[model samples]
Target: KGCTWRTVSVDKIVTRDCHSKVFGDIVQATQPPACLDACGSQKTNTSSSCWVDCFYKAAAGPDSGKPGGKVAGMSFAELTAAWEHPFLPEDQGGCPPVKPKPPWFAHTTSVEQKM
Candidate 1:
């Protein structure tokens, strides 16, 4: 007896507002806030999810991608497009600010300006 496949529910998916062209997948992340330096609204586990999903899809190839990148078959362009939403609402404080921070440094910076 053995598990067949790894099943990640759609609900678990954290959609990021940003997109990446290099990688064909959503960019949702959950490392921490850069501005707040203490949880600026990043979804939990989204970063891991994004990483796994991206790797899986990449290894699967761009021509055989699924989900938003589906075109009856995965395409490089589609994969990249699918990765449009990388940050979930929780991951980010709603729409990304004029300037967004990387997941790892999302909530670890001080917003207060030094005089």
Candidate 2:
């Protein structure tokens, strides 16, 4: 009753070769390889020193290191607007207000993960 749920991110998974030993009968996946969207590159790009150490500091091309300031010459107001997009009114592009559901529910589903 007191089980803890943990999310496994696909980024950390390194795909292993499937053999007959591991799988009894392996059938070709119904969907195309591209459509499967299976995890590929898990490389994490470092942007920690992206602004300070790069030519951006000199040419100032990447001037503002803050988020949403990617455009070469975006004003602070523009940056702020970009950052606060999620908080906009529902009439705008913001997410619709969420209605809380009751604790009691008749329908239920189970999630099973096989490694």
Best by lDDT: 1
True lDDT of residue 35, candidate 1: 16
lDDT of each: 0.39, 0.32
lDDT of 1 by residue, 1-115 (tens): 8859874633333323333322332322221233122223432333555444444434454344555554233455655545543433535433242343356855565567422
lDDT of 1 at 75: 52
Alpha carbon deviation, residue 48, candidate 2 (Å): 14
Worst 10 residues of 2 by lDDT: 21-30
Which window of 10 residues has the lowest lDDT sum in candidate 1? 27-36
Give a tens-digit lDDT track for model 2, residues 1-115: 8989785632222112222111111111211334122323311111334312332322222444557555354345644554344345546544334444454633544454322
My TM-score estimates for the predictions, one after another, are: 0.22, 0.25
Q: Which stretches of candidate 2 lie over 4 Å from their true place?
A: 1-71, 98-115
